[model samples]
Every structure is written in structure tokens, then in C-alpha cells.
Target: MLFYNKNILIVGLGLMGASLGQALIKRRQSKDDFKVLGYARKQQTVDIALDNCIIDQGSSDLESMAKQADIIVLCVPMLSIESSLQAIKPFLKDQVILTDVGSVKDEVIRASKKVFGNMPNYFVPGHPIAGAEKSGVMAANSELYDCHQVILTPDIYTDKIALNTIESIWKFVGAHVVEMNVEHHDHVLAATSHLPHLLAFSLVNTLNHRSENREIFHYAAGGFRDFTRIAASETTMWHDIFKCNKDALLEVLNSFTADLDILKEAISSNDEQTIKSVLSEAKTAREYFTEVLQARSNK
Candidate 1:
């Protein structure tokens, strides 16, 4: 048990943090190895988490909790992570292993270096590829991370022991842990996660501005619903993400735009072959993803 008899401090009682607390509490029911405590900027969020029994205790005093924690997981948005790290820096124990669930990692690591004067070996940056359009503690669930991918971006200076401990905790919560460098992680996520979300939000807004908006939504099919589901995600969180990871996001966006132009030209010029080729390629790519998901499930 990596967290055996440890006090795990989860900062931010939002969807990721609350769900992690629930998973830790569920694990404790059998092993009694770790205790989960929570901290949130809002007292109401802390109270809600306590009332839901997601956390063993809750507090707004981050420094106090940081001093007592064996592991600290920052589950706040990408932009808030820097401030969160700075808040706990004064009290952060040398032995404490720190990690985060922020989607963008390069900025988090950069912030860590700025605050600490160097990247601390105990700080293992991570991103969990699991979430929903829903936000807040009420949307949290213990099974949110089950079978999900959690990527850890650790450099050569990172402590191996701390890396192993963080990996073990994620695995305990039924996540498939993978390791990669910060740049690669950011680039991959920009293409796979960020671009899709941006497109979803943009598409929804475009449709909403049309005169037939109500009719469009009323007659929307499952495909439209599935594609735009992420558009309902918290605007503030995504706004921060876009700002923090603009470079990688823009690179992916340009590629996607080029693809869109190709399709637009194909249709405009009445080129049947080009249109069919694009559709066939997209279908193949999607089917490949389905096959990969099924294979992982079978394991």
C-alpha cells in the first residue's frame, strides 16, 4: 500500500478532487491504510464534500493541511495550479510527494520551477484523461477513473520513489498509468483532447447564433449530442486551459482547419472522389480507436 497510514491532502474539491477522495475512502474501507482530507477555496464546497463523506475532514487552511500531508494532489484547473503550489510551498514537507490532475503539464512544471527555484524531485506532474461535462463535487464519483488513462510527466531529476508512489495510487484507483515527457504529453493531449473540446464549444456557439437554433437543437440526433456533449463543460476551466496551452492548441487547430478546408473545397468543386476519401479515412481512424478500446477492456 503506497499510501499506507498516510494523510493524503486533496486540494480543490471539484470533480477530480472529490472523486479522488471518494475512491480513497472506498479503498480505506478495506485496508485502512490512508485517510483523505480536502481543501477548497470556498467553504461551501468543503462543507459539501464533508457532508457527502467524500473526505474524512475538510479545511480552508491550506498551509496547515500541507504541513501534515504525506501526499498532496492539486486537482484544480490548469491556471490555478501555480497559485495552489505557491500557497502550499511555505509548509510543504520535504518528504511529501506532490502531483496534479491538470490537463496541461508544461505550464504546471514551469510554475513549479519558478516557485521552488528548481523543479523539486518530489513533484510528479500528472494528467488524468477522465472527466465529464459536469463540474463540482456533486458530479464526482468513485468510479470516474476506473479504466481511465493517467499520464505522469516526470523528468530525470524526479525522485523515483515519489514517481512509483504516485503511479501506485492511480493504479489502486483502477487507472492505467503511463509515463512520458512533458512536451510529448502536451502535444498529444492538444490533438486528442483540447482540439475536440474547442471544436465542440465553437460548433455549439455557431449553431446557437443561427436563426433556427431552437429547431436545430430540438431535432438534434445522437451524433450531434455525442459530439457536442463536452461543450457543456465549465467555461472558466476551459478558458484557462486554452490560454495556458495556446501554442500546442493552435498547432493542432491549424491542422484541423486545413483538413476542414480540404473537405470544403472537395464539396464546393463537386469532387466525389476527394469527399469519399476524406470520409473513408475518418471512418477508419474512428474504427481503429474502437478496436483499441475493446482490446484494452478485454485485458
Candidate 2:
């Protein structure tokens, strides 16, 4: 009902975009209430989405879709988001509400400003804090965002109506919407999401490069699999995310390095008390995090 009688165009029919199309289709109340259109660079993605009934229509031409769209959601990677914006800028109607699902917000905000000269009042910058290790339309699911957090990083110049519409759409898709500034979103996500992925990728690569990699994998258990699951995420997307949020990522990486050094020194010195204290602290933090997650889920 939030987007009643609206033509919503989704750019890039990958995991996030395809999932969004499915969500919107599930919420459709009448033939005229809402329509979902998807555009991807690959015609194969469009064909797959159409066959799955994820979108009412699909196309490889972005400009034509943008011309008819009342709302456009950019589901492309952080690095390509600017190009997508630029491509559709010439075709966007004055009332079109533009938004994105990129993980990094600051870079997106900058990109929009660069393309439009001034940030468009209708552009709402957002990040949906949900995904899987898989990529592409085949991996999309309507339940992917159910009860997940979606953060909106709106600037002062953003239109109130447009922001509300974007928030409503995410909430309708079963996301718990939250709002913050772009800088804070980047900094927090760097510590919580980006750093972990970086560590996972590094750990898996380091182990794979060793001569004993076969043995290492043979002896690996659930813990290794759990930690390395995210390392299987699409490399191109992660590469763009890391590049866009490098400053915030670097800050968190340095802090993590310092903590790692402390653990290394304790282990090398065979300091039983220090090691015990560190592990105890980590256990306490982990317990607290679990409790927090449980509480959020209950909400």
C-alpha cells in the first residue's frame, strides 16, 4: 500500500534486486496497485527473473525503464552505482524517488552529488543489512530481508515525503528500518561487517597457500566453515565495498591489529593469566552480543 499505483524499477537483477522484486510482487494487492520492473546488464538475468515471476517485466535497457519509473532502486555494486545513476539521470522524472541498497553510504552520496551537481531531494541513501554468501538472481529469496535491519542515511536536503516512501517500502518488505548519518553508517559497518569479511578472506587464503592446505581442510570442523562462509561471497562486490569504505575499514583494521598483537605477545610469553583474562573478556563480549541479537529477533 505504501507504493500504491507506482512503477518501481529495480536496477541490477542480482541477489538484492531480484529479492526486492519478489518482495514487491508478494505485496501486490491489485492489478493497478503496483508494478515491478527489473533491468540488468545481462539479458539472461532479466529472462530468469521474468520466468520466476519475480518481476512483472524485465529489460536490459535502463534508460527506457527509468523514463517510466516512479521509483528506482539501485541494487548495483558500490563502484558501479555512480555509473548507474549517471545513466538514468537524463531520463528521471522530476517526481521519481531514487534510492539504493548499497552497503557503503558516503561514497554513494558523493556519487549522487557528482552526477546531479546538487544532491537530488528525492534521492534517499540506504543500506540493507542483509545478504548471503551467494550472488546472482538464482540465489534470491523473498525472505532474505525479513526482520533484517535496513539503514537509511538521509542528508538534510532530502525530501521528507521521498524518505518516508523509501522507509515504508523497506518496512513493507519486512525490514526493520533505522536512520543514521552516512559517516556513522560507514564506521559502524566497517567494524561489524567489512572487517570480518576481510579477516575471513585473508584467513582462508593464507591457509590455502600453505603446502598442508589439503590436510588443513581435511581436519577443519564446523567452526572453520562458519567463519569462512562469508569468504565465499562474490569477490567483485566485496572488492568494491572495501575500496569505497577504505578509510573506515582501515581504522577498524588498525584497532584489530593492536588486539591481535596483544594476544600474540601473551601466547609467546606463555602468560597464563593474561591469556585467561583475554579469553574470558572475549567470552563475555560474545555472550553479550548473542543476548543482543536474541533481543532484536524477539522484537
Candidate 3:
């Protein structure tokens, strides 16, 4: 299950896929043990990836590329995972390892099970906790994953050798790899990543629809702009992620809504002590979080 001398195909040459290809291609330049290939639905995307040297070979054909791939890393949207799995299943070689860079793990597992009728032994579900608000092939960067966490959720059906090979591949790109079960991964992400994006999109959308939208945006401060930066991310991708992880997302959203109501009641009642206590606790928590990140970086 060694990745060395293998043909690693990256399906969907978008930001994540192209960045991964760039990282792998850059490393193989010195080692020359493997090759990096890319596939996109659009020929124009393949051409752009080739022009940027993000891949050793590029194509718009999935079947042809899947046939030659010793390992396939799906980098498509959450909703597209099932379709991609269905398309590539018939062409996958016996030992070819299947992995993905999807944010939601539960949906991926469900899709895999639905497509293959059971979990494929060589299919290891993965999610790299790395990305940018900006996307597409032109936004590809070789260092996008450096020092970031990559989570792998391997079930009993997952092949040990395939898991190890996928872990090694992530490490090769300078990522700190970790493992978690599908449920834990999805719940953690729902609270941390998905909720924040949901808030950002909601805030922006709410303000944009107001009658004074122009004046509101004109007077927006740096903090407001920074907090909403993720609102600028591609809509279709987030839309799919929200739908795929709705159960978990809704759980967290409900919790946040209850907390928000408490805050609103306190504000309406002018409860100084309640307001001060909540604010102080949040400030302390943020400071502790900063210290933790600093400690990790120093390590």
C-alpha cells in the first residue's frame, strides 16, 4: 500500500485538489518516486492547472484517469462525493485506495456505502481541515496544508494498509494527521467550522437585504469585514455542506439560538451583572484559546 511509484489522481482540480497536486508535484520533483495527475469537469480548468504546473498530467475524462490511478483523492463538493464515487467505482483498480478532502465525514461514509453497497476495503474517508475563502485552480498554493490538521475516519471495513498509505501521503505534504470516528468528526466540525460559516453567511445575508444595506456596508468596520470574510466563499459548496450535515448543524444551531435568546433577554432587561459575567467569561475563553494555539506553534 506504499504510495511510492504510484499514480495519484486528484479528481476535481479546484482549490483543494490543485493545491494538493501542487504540493505533491513539488515534492516528487526531488524524489521522483510518484506522479501527480489531475482531473476536472472542464477542459479549461485542466488547461489552467497544467499551465500552473499543479499536476504532471491533466484531463477532463474521469474514467480514463480513474483507470490509471493507483490512488484517488476526491476533492469535489460534499454533494458531489456520491456522484464521483459512482462514476469512479467501476474503473478503480483492485488495490487502488480511495480518499477524499470533504469537510463532512458522515455524508461521505453514507455515500460510499450507497455507491459500493458496502464500504470498500481500500476506501479511507479523510478531511483536511485546511482551505481558503478563495477557491478554484488559480487560488492553488503548495503550502495550503502546511502545519494544518488532516482528519481520517476509518471504520472496521477500512484496510489498514490503505489507511497507513493515506496517512503517509498527508504527512508528505507537511500536514499533522489525526484520526477520529465519523460521528465525532462530524459533530466537532458542526460546532466549530460549520456554525461559524453559517453565522457569517446569515449575518451578511441579513444585512444585504436591509433597506439601508448600502449605508450599512459603507459604515462597516474592519472587524465586521474580517468576521464576514468567509461569507465570500463559493455558495454552492457551502449550500451542499449545510444540507449534507443538516442534523449535526441543526443541533449546534439550536444550542446557539438558545444562548442568543438569553443574551437578548439580558440586554432588554439591562442586566449589567449578567452581561458583564458573560462577556468576561468569553474574553477569558478567547485568551485561553490564544495561549493554546501559541503553545502548539511553539512545540
Candidate 4:
């Protein structure tokens, strides 16, 4: 395994961090072979991580624990990325690999480099493109990234050696990895990932306040469950995503609003053919996406 000889320091032992630890352990990554450390704000969280075997050791100090790591994976909230990066900037070892699980990659890349000057070739901005609707270390599991997509946004400055090693790390955990630019990642994700999450949150909020809650609750089925499923995901992570990708997300949101208005007009006009054709096209499009998704899964 790629992590076999590396010491990994996971900053913030939250859901993503703990899940990564479990995944590494399930893959038979030994504690001595690859030291896994966790940095959490709470002593209780540190104890929990140790009890769950998510990490070999836990500490609340970044610089102290970070000095012993070969790779540092920042799994904190987006708003905290810059500050955390700065905190560890002064003491980062040369050639030490760095990565993050943040949804917003462009800003993360910029801030990371700004705080830590002369980054080594191993600093790659990565997102697993996978998570659960649960938060915290207690809810973490090892199979979170099984057959999932891990997107790496490697810019010109990204060290080729570093990117390849990062890719290997994800591959060892059963993730199919792909490379893309930071801007394209932000734009495309705003449509496919970010927008859907935003809509899910809005839909659940709208339904929760309705007068006929009993009726809505009674009819919650596959569609409702699927729609609201991601809505239950970690709000802090999603909130940071929206806030950090504000400009890109807002642009896409505007386009979506325009499309929704067109559908609203068609529905209001009682245009049966328009509604039928629209729904049919959507179903067809979703089928294409499913086919692509299945192809990736089979790999």
C-alpha cells in the first residue's frame, strides 16, 4: 500500500478524517508501518478516536503533532483551511506531502500556497467526491469511499510525483481517481454536486414548515428519501462549500433559476406536452449519468 511506509497526520478528527483512518486500517495499514495521528479540538474526541482505533495517537496541537508526519491531510471546514494552513506553515518539513478534503479547491489551493511558501512537489488539492449524510467521528466508517470517485485538481505548480503518490493513496482504498483543473472542478461541481445539495437543503426546509406536515411525512418515499438524503449530510461542510464557492455557485444558481422559471411557466400554462417532453428528456439524461456511474463502479 502507498501508506505503508508513511506517517499520516489527519488534521481534525471529524467524520471524513476518522473515515479515512478506518479505511486505512481496514486496508491493513499498520500503525508502525504507517503512523496515523489525529488532531482534534476536544479531548473527548481524542479519546473517542483512540478507542475506535481511528488513529495511533491524538493531539490538540498542530505543530507538535505535525512535525512527525510524512503526509498531512486537512479535513477541516473550508473557513478554517487558511488559518490551519497558516498555523502549520512555519514548521512544515520540506518535501512533506499535503492534501485536503475540502469541496472548494481553488481557494484552498491559493490559501495553502500563500500560507506555506515554496510548497513541495507533493502538495495536491484533492476531494474524494464521496461522503455520508452523517457528521462526527462516532458516525465514521471504513467503507465510505468504496468504489467512489476521488477528484484531484492539479495545477501547473503541482508536483507530478506528488500527484501520482496521492492518486495511488486513493486507489489503494478502492477509489477511481481523476484529474481536473481547479476552476473546472469548482464550476462542474457547482452544477452536479453543489447545486443538488443546495436544492436538497431548500426542499427539506420548505417541506418541514408546511401546514400539512402529516401528509408530507406520510408520503415520504423513494423520491422524497433520495431527495432529502443528502440534505441530512454535515451542514458545516456544506455550508463552507456554499460560502467558499459563492461566486461560482451563484452563477450556476442563476442559470438553474431561469430553467426552473421556464418549467414553472409551462406547468402554469397547463402545457401537457411541454411537461411530458421535459420530464422524458430528464429521465433520458439521468439514464446516461447512471450508465457512466455504473461504468466507473465496475472498474
Candidate 5:
């Protein structure tokens, strides 16, 4: 639970998994205790991870790696969670604490219950709000999650001991861990994280389709570039997250669409007062959120 003297198995050695391996190695924990083993579908990735010292040992084989782990952290995409869970279930040891880093949780929790045969006590659902526009092993950094928020979704069947132990693990990785239920976690992330990614992708696509001068995009500034930066994140990962949390994301998307429609109508009608009012409100809202974030950081 403390990750001390425990074999921590990380599946899918992408950015998150590789970064986790590095963080564990940098910690006071032993390489054997937090022995970061993994299994990538690519043998090249397996070799690269071992060569880079990002992992103790890894292979293209899941069953072999799963058997030797004390804790199995599923770091693949949300859509892959179910299949990964199924594939590794046959090899899972009863004493292992199984967890995931999926963006969406309701479907994952349900699928996990079935895969683990309704023993939700052994499962821990987590989502670390730290990543990059770039993915894969090459983009990993040991400090990717430094001071980042890691949300843990614990439900009725969730064991307190298991949840607390995982919290300790995230803390060791320098994450500020917080607890929330599945629905609350999904809904909040839908607005704060998922919706932004969705909008970023949409905004970038809209620009691509517009009849703008060829040099318009070339003249983008820091703010413009930063706004759309995350649009470059793994498409398959975001696509899977959107699908898993479809209903909640759709609800937020609908509300966002209605607001955009209102803004569009005001623009066409030359409603300068309406536009100013909206922009002023947006500025105030941003400032308020910024202050809150700053306060948390100072704490």
C-alpha cells in the first residue's frame, strides 16, 4: 500500500506510466519496492523503457508481468480500460490493489466490478489532472505530476484501507490527492477538463475551415497558442474519454452551444453592449478562478 517493498506494475508505458516509473525511482523507495514493471504492445517501447531506466522490467507480454506485481496500475486510455481489465484478470493476484488513471469513472467502475467479479473493495478509481499535449514514452518527465491534483473516486464497495493506501502512493509522487464520488468526479471534470479539450479541438477545427488569410495562423500569439495547445494531445485518448462520459459531456456541450448561439446572435445584431457585458463577466470569472488557484498554491 505504501509502495515500499511492493512490486508496482504499470500497464501501457506511455507518458503517464513512464513518468510514474521515474517518480518512484526518484523517491526514497527502493527500485525493488516500487519496481516499475510494465507491458507495452510494442517491443520497441519495452526495450526503450528498460534502456532509459524508466522501468525495471517490461515486455510485450501482459500475463507474465501481471503475475509478479503487488499493485497493478492501469494507465491505458479509458476505452482500453475494459479490455485491459479483462485481459489481465486471468493473471491478477488476489492480494493486488488494482487501480486506473481513467478520465471517466462510472463505466470504468461498473466494468471493473464485473471484471474483478464484483469485488470493488480491491479497486481504486483515480484520475490525475496532469499530462502533456505530447504523449508516448519519449515525452515523459519525472515531474509531470508535481503539485498536480489527483482525484480518487471511492464508492460504496471501495475499501477505506485500499483508498488510503493509494492516497499515500499519489502523495509520494507529489500529487495533492482529493476524494470524490464517481458522478461528481465525472461531472466536474466534464466542465473543467473534458469540455475545454472538446472546445479546443472544435476551435482549432473551426479555424482550419475558415476562409482566413494563409498567414493568419502564423501570426498567433502566446495566448492564442496556449489556448489551443492541448488540442494536440492524444486524439485516441480524448476520443475514448468523450465516449465513456458521453452523457455528462453532452449535457455540458449542449449548454455551451446554447451560450455560443446567444453570442453569435448578439454579434450579428451588432449588440455591442451585450458583447461587452459578456466579455466583462468572463474576465471577472477568470480572475475569481485564478485567485482561488493561487490561494491553493500558496497553501
Candidate 6:
């Protein structure tokens, strides 16, 4: 109902944007259902989305699409957020609600502030904590966000109606919506998502350069393959995230390095007690995390 008769424009027709369009199309219930529009930098990407019915309509032209959207969701890379904002600013309707699905909210907030001279009341900074290792329009799945968590970071200037509109749309797509401040959102994602991706990329790179690299890969077990799976994610997108969120990521990285050093010392000194203590704590924490995830899925 929140999207009734609305023109929902997705400003970047990549995995996240295309997935959102697919989900919206799947949720259509009647003739009054909202329209889904998509925009990508390339006409080919737009054509692919249109051909696949991922979006009702799409184009490579941002200005034309921007003028028609009642709700605009920017799904571009972190580095392009400001540029995208600038491109669409002139055409945005006064009633349009703007949002984003970027991983780093602090950077998004800064970009929005810089573009608008302050964060607009109708602009909501959001992050959908869901994705696939694969990227691009072809990889988009209608259920990618099903039962997933979508975090919205709204500041003091955010309009309640605009925030509720974003929340309603995400919930309609099967995501569990939650709210957090920009700083807290960035910090939490740094420790959980960003750090893991960094470690995965680093581990894969390290193994790939080893003398026994081929043998290492050839003999990779289930755990090794599973842990490194995220290394196959889109490099450019992750690169932008790392650049935009360096401060928070570095904070978490420092903490992780300190722990890693302690573990290294324990292993080097052959301290059985210390080794067991660290491993035990990690195992227990992992179990608790698993429990929490399972519980949320059950909900």
C-alpha cells in the first residue's frame, strides 16, 4: 500500500538494484500496483533488466528517470554515491523519498549532507544486510532479501513519514527492518561484514601467492572453500566500501590484528593452555552466533 501508484526508481541496475526490482515485480498484486523503473550506466544492462522483466521499464538516462520517480533508491557503489546524488538532484520531486542500500551509512550521510547542504528530511540512509557472492543483473534473485535484516540509519532531520515509507517497502519485500544511528551502523558492519570480507580476500591472496599455491587450492577442504567463497565477490564494489569506510574498518582491523598476534604468540611458544583458551572462546562465540542466526531465521 505504501507503494500504491508510486514510481519506484532503482538508480543502479546491478545485483542489489535488480534484485529489488525483481522482488517488487513479484509482489505486484493488482492493477494499482506500483511501477518499477531501473537505471544503469549502460544501455545493455538496462536492456537486460527490461528483457528479463526485472523492471517494468528502464533506461541509461538518469535525468529522465529521476524526474518520474516517487521513491528513488540509489544502489550505486560507495564511490559513486555523491556523483549519483548530484546527477539526480535537479529532477527530484519535493515529495520524493530518497534512500540508499550502501553498506557504509556514515559515508552516505556525509554525501547526502554535502549534496543537499544538510541531510534532507525525506532522505533515509539504509543498508540491506543481504547479498550474494555473485554480482550483476544476471545474478539478481527475487528472494535475496527474504528474511534478511535491513538496517536504516536516520538522523535528526529525517522525516518520520519518509522513514516509515522506506521501512514499509523493505518489509513488503520480506526483510526484517531495524533502525540504528549512522555511527553505530558503520561500527557494527565494520566488525561483522567488512572485516570478514577483508580477511577472506587477504587469505585468498596470501594462499594464491604461496609456493604450493596450486596444491593448496587443489587440496582445499570444505572449510577452506567456504571461508574463501566471499573472495569471489565483486572487487570494485568492495574496494569502494573499503575506501569509504576505512576509519571504521581500520578500527576493527586493529582489534582483530591484536587478537591474531596473541594467537600467534600462543602458537609460537607452544602454550597449550593459551591455545586452548583462545580456541575455546572462539568456538563458544561461534556457537552463540549460530544460535542467534538460527533464531532469527525461525522468526
Q: Higher-lDDT candidate among 3 and 6?
A: 6
Give the 10-residue window scoring lowest on summed lDDT in candidate 6: 24-33
Superposed by TM-score, candidate 2 places the C-alpha of residue 69 at a distance from the truth, in angstroms, of 0.4
Q: Candidate 1: which pairs clash?
A: 5-33
Task: At residue 168, give the lDDT of candidate 4.
Answer: 82
Clashes, model 2: 1
lDDT of 3 by residue, 1-299 (tens): 27888999999998999999999878664546898889999999999999997988879999889999999999999999999999998898988998999999999989988998888889899999988979999999999998889999998878999999999999899898999999999999999899999999999889889999878988999977976797988887899899989999999999999998998999999999989988999999999999988886676
For candidate 6, give the lDDT of residue 206: 96
Q: What is the C-alpha lDDT profile of model 4 across 1-299, one tens digit per residue?
A: 56567878899988889988878767863456677888898888888998998888888877788888878889899889899888877777777888988899977976766776654457888999888877899987888888988999877877877788788878877788999888999998999899999999999889999999668978898988988887988877888999989989999999999988988999999989988888999999999999998897677
Write one digit per residue (lDDT tens) for candidate 1, span 1-299: 77788889999999999999988788665546788889998889889998887898889888777888999999998888889988998897778999999988998988898898888999999999999879999998999899999999999999999999999999988999999999999999999989999999988989999999878998999978977798989888899889888999999999999989999999999999999999999999999999999998887
In model 2, the Cα lDDT at residue 96 comes to 96
Q: lDDT (0-100) at residue 140 of candidate 2?
A: 80
Query: Is 1 or 6 the stronger prediction by lDDT?
Result: 6
List model 2 lDDT by residue over 86-133, tens digit each: 999899988999999999998998898899887788999999999998
Where does candidate 3 have its weakest 10-residue lDDT segment? 24-33
Q: Which one wins by lDDT: 5 or 6?
A: 6
* Per-candidate local distance difference test: 0.90, 0.92, 0.91, 0.85, 0.86, 0.92
Supply the TM-score for candidate 2: 0.98
lDDT, residue 63, model 2:
81
Please, what is the TM-score per model? 0.97, 0.98, 0.97, 0.94, 0.94, 0.98
The TM-score of candidate 3 is 0.97
Q: Which residue runs of candidate 5 sit more than 4 Å off their true CA positions?
A: 117-119
On lDDT, the stronger of 1 and 5 is 1
Query: With candidate 2 superimposed using the best TM-score fit, by how many Å does residue 124's alpha carbon deviate from the native?
Result: 0.5
Q: Which 10-residue window in model 5 sums to the lowest lDDT?
A: 25-34
Q: How many residue pairs clash in each candidate?
A: 1, 1, 0, 0, 0, 0
Tens digit of per-residue lDDT, candidate 6, span 201-264: 9999999999998789989999789778989989889999999899999999999999999999
